[model samples]
Target: MASSTASQQPAQVWDESQCVAALAQLERLQAQIDDLRLTIPRVVAPLSPQITKRPELFAAFKKAAVGSQSNIKAFRTTWQSQETQALFEHTKASLEANSDLTPGAQLPRYGWEQKEIRDRDAEARRRDGAKDGEDKAVVSMSKEERERILQEFRAANGQLKVFSKDDDRDILIHFISGGLKYRFHVVVNSETNGGEHLDAECLGNGEPFVSITRCVSLRPHANELKPLLDMIAAYKNVQSNSCAKCGKLLDKSALVPTARRSKQPEEANEKQETVWEALHESCLD
Candidate 1:
C-alpha cells in the first residue's frame, strides 16, 4: 500500500539540459517568426466605407426638420403673447407660493451676503462722489457760476490767470502785476481737505484766495513783490520753505493760519476765516 502511494506521487525533475534546449527552441522560433514577418509584404488596411446618406432617409430628415422649424415659426409670434408669458407667470407664482413662509413655518437661511458686490458698489459711489467735485478745496460750482466768479475776480484783479490741479482739487491763481507772477491758492480746509466735501464746507463757492505774505501786497512794487514771487516759486516748485519771520524750515503742521483778503468786494469787510498766511506757530507765540 506504501509503494502504491509513493508511485502515485508525481516525480520532481531538476534537468538543466532540457531547460536550455527548450530556451534554444523558443529563441529559434522567435527569430524565424521575425524573419518571416520581414519577408512578407505589409498588409495595408482597407479604407472604411463612406456612409452616404440614402435619398429617402435624407428626404425624410429634411421633411421632419422643415416640419419642426415651421411648427416653431408658427408659434414664435404668439408664444410670447400666450404660452411663454403664461408659463413665466405660472412659474413665478409657483416660486412665490413655495418661497412664502406659512404662519408658524421657519426657513433656514444658508447664503451669505456678497461682500465683493457691496465693495464694488461702494467704490462706484466713491468714484461718482469724486467726479461730482466732492472733497475738493474749491466748492462745486456750475460752469455759469464759475464764469461769473472768474469775471468778477478778473474785473478787480485785471486778467488774473487761474489753473486747476489734482483733478481740480486745488485751484491756483496767477496774478500778473508789477511784471511779476503772484501765485495763490483758493482757500480749502487743510484738515480733511481732500475727503468728501470736507463735510460740505467746500460745497458752495469755495473760501476766498489766501495770500502767502509779500507774494501779493496791497501795493505791487517791483522791489517788494518781485523777490517774494521768486521766494514763492522756490517754495512751491522745490521742497525747502522757510518762514518769513523766523528763517527756520516751515512745517505744514506748525504754520499758523490768518484770514486772507477776500476776492469778493462785497465780503471784504466781513470777518473772514480763510487761511491767507502760513506763518510759524512760534512766531505767533
Candidate 2:
C-alpha cells in the first residue's frame, strides 16, 4: 500500500523548455555528485501499460495529450504538435534500441514503406480475426437471441424507435437527428449475405454511414451491438455539430463538420476537443 501510494503521484509537466532546463540542472548536480563520489538511483523510464493503473496517472497523461494537442483529429488527419512528433520519434527509437536485430530485420521507416508494412499487418490481423469471428458469426444467432439483442438495443437508445419487428434478422428503426427523422434498415449477417457481420443503411441518406460500415465489417470488435450504437451516435454527432452560421448539419457539398469556429481561435487550435462551433470547410468563407 505504501509503495502503491508513492507510485501514483501526479506527474510534473515537462514542456520542451522544462525538459531542457531539467537536463541542465541534472548536469550540474551530476558534477557535484562526482565531486563527492556519491550516486543516486536514476529515474527509470516506464515501459508498462499499467503506468496508468491509477486515476492520477491517467489524468496526467490526459493533461499532456491535451497540452500537446495530440488527441485532436481534424478532417481525419491527426494534429501532431512538436511535442507529439518528438514522442513518436522517441517511441520508434526506443523499439529499435531494445530490439535484437539478428541479421537484417530493420525497423519500419517513416514513409510509404511504414504505411505498407502497417497495411500488411492490419490485413494479417483481419484474417486472424475472421477465423475467430466465425465462432460469433451473426448467422449463428438464434431467433430468440436476435430478438432479445434488438429489444435491448432499442431500450438503450432514446432516439431509436422501433418501426418494425416483423423479421428477427432485419430490424427497421427510426432515429431523430438534426430535427430530421431518419429511418434505418439493419440486417444482421447470414449465409445469404456472406456471413460474420451486421450493418445498417439510412433510408433517407441513400447509403451513408461510412464510419459505421467500416466498423461493422472491418474493425475487430467483441460487442455485437457496437455497430448499431455507432450508427445512432454518427447521426447524433451530425446533429450536435450543425454549422453555426448556416444552421445546417451538412454544407452544400454534403460534408458534415470538417471545420470548427471558436470565439478563441488559438484555444480552438491548441486545446483538445473544445466547445467550438462545428462547421464545414466551405462555410468558413
Candidate 3:
C-alpha cells in the first residue's frame, strides 16, 4: 500500500527562468509607474487677486460664500415682503456703487468718464508741446500694447488685409508691416461667435498666410484708433532682424501695399493707396 501511494504522488518542480521573468516584469511595471509620476503635470492655484494668497482657503471661502447667498436668497423669497425686497436691492446697488467694483456701478461709470477726459486733456497737452504734428502723435508703446491692439482688430475683422477693403465694415486705418499693408476696419456691434471671432484673415501680400496672427477682445476702448497708430509707428521706427519665420534678411525699403489694382481709372480710385512703412517684402504676408 505504501509503494502504491508513493507512485501516485506527483513530483514538485521550480522553474528558475519563470521566476526571473515574473520579477523582471514586476520591476518594469514599477519603473513605468515612477516615470509616470515624474511626467504628470501638477495642479496650480488661480492667480486672481481674490485667490492669489491662500488659494486653498479661497476655494473653501468661495463655497461658503455661495452657500450664504443661497440661504439669503431662500430667506428673502420665503419671508421677505415686496417692499423689503426693493429696499434690499436698493441697498445692494448702493453698496456696489460705494465699492466701485460692480459693473455699471454709478460711481465707477462716472469715474471712468472723468478719467477719459483727463487722459485726453493730458494727451492734447503732450501733443502741443511736441516739435510737430507727427511728433505730437508719437506715443511710446510696448510689445504688449501692440499685441493687444492687433488682437482687438483681429477679433472684430476675423481677417484684416494689408490694404484691402472689407465688404462688411468701414476701414479705419491702413497698417503697414514687413512691406505688407493691413487695413483696420471698425466693426459696429461686434458680437462674439462661439466665444471668439475666429474668421479674421490677413489679406495683405495677396496671400493670407504669410504672417503670424492673434486675437483680442472685440470691445472698443477710448482712443480706439491709437493702438493701430502705435503699431504703425513701431513697425516704421523699430529696426528688426530677419523674417521671424524664414530667417531671411529683409529689405526695409521693399515694403509696399499688396492690394494695388491695375491702371483702370475706376479701379485705381477704389484701390488701396500705397503708403511707405518699414517692413520686409517676404515678411508682409
Candidate 4:
C-alpha cells in the first residue's frame, strides 16, 4: 500500500505543474489580444475617410472668419471716431475756459496778452535806463558781463536772440496759433544735407520739424528773424554741447535740419526758408 501511495503522489505533483504552465500561457495570449485591439484603431484611423475630411471643415471655417474680421474692422473705426470726438470736445472746452470770452457785457482781458504787454513795458524801461547806471553797475557785474553783455545776458538769463552774431547763434521763437507759444535755438548750415543743419534738441524731440528734406523752403522774416536768432544764441551758450530740447549729449554730426508745413498758414509764408535750431530742453519747462 505504501509503494502505491508514493507513485500516486508523483503523478499528482506533475499534474499540478502542467496546470500552472498552461494558465501562464493563457494569460500571455490574453494580454497580446488586448494590445492588438488597442493598436489597430490607431493605425487605421489616418486611412479612414472621416479623419481626412478636415480640409472641407477648414474651408467653411475660413468663410466664417471673413465676417469676424469685418466686424473687428467696423468696431475699430467706431472706436476711433468716438475717441476723436472726445478729444475735440476736451480741446474745445479747454480753449473756451482759457479764453477771455465773457458771458455778459464785462470785458474780459486775455491773460497772456496782458502779461505780454507788462513784459514789453518792463523791457522798454530797462532799455531806456540801461546807460544811466552803467558806471556804477560796471564794478558790480561779473567778468562775463565785461567780456560780453548781450551774449552773457542771453546765455546766463535765457534771453532769446532772433539772429546770430559772430559770437552767438540765432534764436527761433515759435508763435503757435491757438494759444501755443514756444522758443528754440537754431543754426543754418548750408553744407549739411543740401544746406540744412538743425539744433540737436529739435532733432531729438521726434516732432514733424526735424528733417532736412522738409525744411527746403522755410525761412524767417524780419519780425521772426531776430527773435529766432536770439533764441538760438541763448541755447548755444547755455546748452553748449548738449541737446537743447532733451538735455542729452548727442552726436552733432547726426543732427539734420528739418521743417514741416506750419500748422498756422497765416504765421508763415509759402516761400519761406526753414532752418534748424537747438534749445534748452528746460525751455520747454
**Strongest candidate by lDDT:** 2
lDDT per residue for candidate 1 within 104-211, as digits (tens), equals 133112111222222234446546654554433443334454445545544544455656444443456565433445556543233344222211111112111222
What is model 4's C-alpha RMSD? Answer: 34.5
- Where does candidate 2 stray beyond 4 Å? 1-139, 192-196, 205-223, 237-254, 257-285
- Clash pairs of candidate 1? 135-197
Off by over 4 Å in 4: 1-85, 88-143, 146-285
Model 3 score (lDDT):
0.36
Tens-digit per-residue lDDT, 117-213, candidate 2: 3334545665877788767745455677767766776676666677545456666776676666656666766566454455555554212332123
Candidate 3, 1-285: lDDT as tens digits: 123323222232224333233334334444444444432121121333455458666675666556555655554453355534443344444444355554433221112222233334444543553324332332233446545555565555433333323332233545565575655343322333311111233333312222211111111121244433334333333444344334445323232222211111344556552332333333332
Candidate 1: stretches off by over 4 Å:
1-139, 163-171, 176-181, 184-285
TM-score, cand. 2 vs. native:
0.33
> Which 10 successive residues of model 1 have the least lDDT summed?
199-208
| lDDT tens per residue, model 4, 1-285 | 123223222222224224233333334444444544544444444454654577865654555555455555554464355443443344345344455444323422222232233334444544554444333322222334323644554464443333444333333333332232334445433332232233323322222232221122122231232333433333233324444355555323233222222122244566553333443221221
In candidate 3, what residue range of length 10 has the lowest lDDT sum? Answer: 212-221
Q: Which candidate would rank higher by TM-score, 1 or 2? A: 2
Candidate 3 off by > 4 Å: 1-169, 175-181, 186-188, 191-201, 205-225, 241-285
lDDT of 3 at 117: 35
Task: Give candidate 1's whole-model lDDT.
Answer: 0.36
Assess every candidate by TM-score.
Answer: 0.20, 0.33, 0.19, 0.20
